[model samples]
Target: MVNDIIADERSPVSASGHAYGEAERREANLIYEYADHLQRHGHRVARQLIQIPGEPRPHRTDLYDTSTNRLIEAKGTLHREAVRLAIGQLFDYRRFLSPEPALGLLLPAKPSADILELCRALGVKIIWQEGGGFTESSGG
Candidate 1:
């Protein structure tokens, strides 16, 4: 699912023929690594695709933990813009997810206090790297 999105978003070279290099690819790899961490900890994870209304091609979610019914949106950074983007995507994708799983945002590290507050206000769980492993907050 993620591969499809990466393929669609590919635009390595612009009109100027300058290569914008590995940022996107690295972000994808980061998400995959996070997914792997979940699986290693005994979570049953899968990449999910949501069929957009009136759209032929579906949108893919970063990770879905079937056992816990968590829908996670992975972001390479937890800055304000990235956090906002992930929140919006998660909310939009939820409408198409059956049974309405718990929403979560997976980040490389903990976000700013404001970002954390926003997720808490929206009732979105936050999973971020801390020390040598990942940490989670209920976003309550």
Candidate 2:
């Protein structure tokens, strides 16, 4: 895994002309923090690179929990759009991985009721910061 690229706290890289904003920074921090939380629980979380068919570049996952066999995508906010985007990313990332890990979404806070239902319907585990640790939705 890329030596925990996001965990290194390096300057953000923006693909578009605009620079990285607070939202991007927040998402990166959330991913890093959640990965640390997973580590303390004796789980091995690592960044992953996937080369999709007909794609010239690789896509990087926020973190993959090797111990639990789950792939996680983190979003900075609980907004519907953000969660929707994360869901899309997890699905896209899943098809290319060899072991087909269970999908997870890490958020800064618990999502709204509808959002929670949406994730549940899609079989996406919702994990959010709670107290000093993280809380995960039941099932996959």
What does the lDDT read for residue 24 in candidate 1? 47
Which portions of model 1 miss their true places by more than 4 Å? 1-23
- Model 1, span 17-133: residue lDDT tens: 887545445567666776677778887777787888799878878778888998988777656887889999999998888898899998878888888888999989998878877
Count of steric clashes across candidates, in order: 0, 0
Among these predictions, the greatest lDDT belongs to 2
lDDT of 2 by residue, 39-117 (tens): 7778888878888889997888888899988999988877788888999999999998878899999998887888888
Provide the RMSD of all predictions against the true structure, rounded to 1 decimal. 3.5, 2.4
Off by over 4 Å in 2: 1-13
Task: Quote model 1's TM-score.
Answer: 0.81
What TM-score against the true fold does each predicted structure earn? 0.81, 0.89
